[model samples]
Target: MTSSDTSVGPSSDLSQNAENFNWLLSRFAGNTAGVRDAIAVSSDGLMIAQCIEGERADVDRLSAIVAGMTSLAGGVAGSYRLGTLNKVIVDMADGYLLISAIGCGSVMGVIASKQANLGQVAYEMTLFANRAGAALTPELIRELKNHIQV
Candidate 1:
């Protein structure tokens, strides 16, 4: 199976607590311009949750891709003794991709247009992800159970 097909179990109470995460991400997304997508992924390259409207962006594939890129960046940072990997940015022709390591294996990502205020977007996303981490831990367990049942 492709790496994107791999699944990470969700929390049993995810339905109850998911709103907390979604709310925070939504707020962040709203403040950023040209932000087309957002997603949460595990450090092991598994998709935990995603926020996309209209077209689907292949959360699993993107998660794996981001995880790999994050890992590589982390390794480079460690080599330079630059402390932890806080965030990464990839500037493309049309937009920018930003990823922030929340806690443990969780990461938050945002895709925004080239015109977006990267500094503001990064700051907001970081704050939101940090706050969401607490809510996500237990919720993840609950969602995992729910996913298993389904």
Candidate 2:
């Protein structure tokens, strides 16, 4: 899917941590030209936060997709002793799905347009992971999990 013009901010009632995550995700998706949506998921496949320009259902589906993909990739890496799984990129005919680790067994997923510069998107994703990684501690993850409803 391509970019959308609609803009939405994080909800006011979100906890500070969740709000920060939403803000980070929003910045990543909004500032990146070809990004369509983004979501953060826990290792247990729970959606923690999202920055979507369209329907919430779509982002929820994306959360599940990315989590499943990450699990599969991790399984393959472990089976082949290829070391830790870093990222997975699904390049489709119309767009791309990019998933990257965000530390503490959490991940961030991005949906980008067909015209997106993969190199740029990957670089920005790396930056996002680095920025959000340290903050994803166990307690914060639990808090986010409790508050965010997928």
Q: What TM-score goes with each of the models?
A: 0.76, 0.88
- RMSD, each candidate, Å? 6.0, 2.8
Q: In model 1, where do residues sit more than 4 Å from their true spots?
A: 1-15, 54-57, 138-150
Candidate achieving the largest TM-score: 2
Q: Write the per-residue lDDT of candidate 1 for residues 9-109, one digit (tens) a residue.
A: 23444565665555566566655667777777766666666655532346555666788888888899989999887889999999988999876667887
Q: After superposition, how far is residue 139 of candidate 2 from its true place, in Å?
A: 1.4
Question: Relative to the unseen true structure, what is the C-alpha lDDT of residue 1 in candidate 1, on a scale of 0 to 100?
Answer: 15
lDDT against the true structure, per candidate, is: 0.68, 0.82
Off by over 4 Å in 2: 1-15
What is the Cα-based lDDT of residue 37 in candidate 2?
82
**Per-residue alpha-carbon lDDT of model 2 for 1-150, expressed as tens digits?**
235533334667666766787678788887887998888899999987777766767767888899999999999999999987688999999999999998899998888999999999999999888888877888878877776653
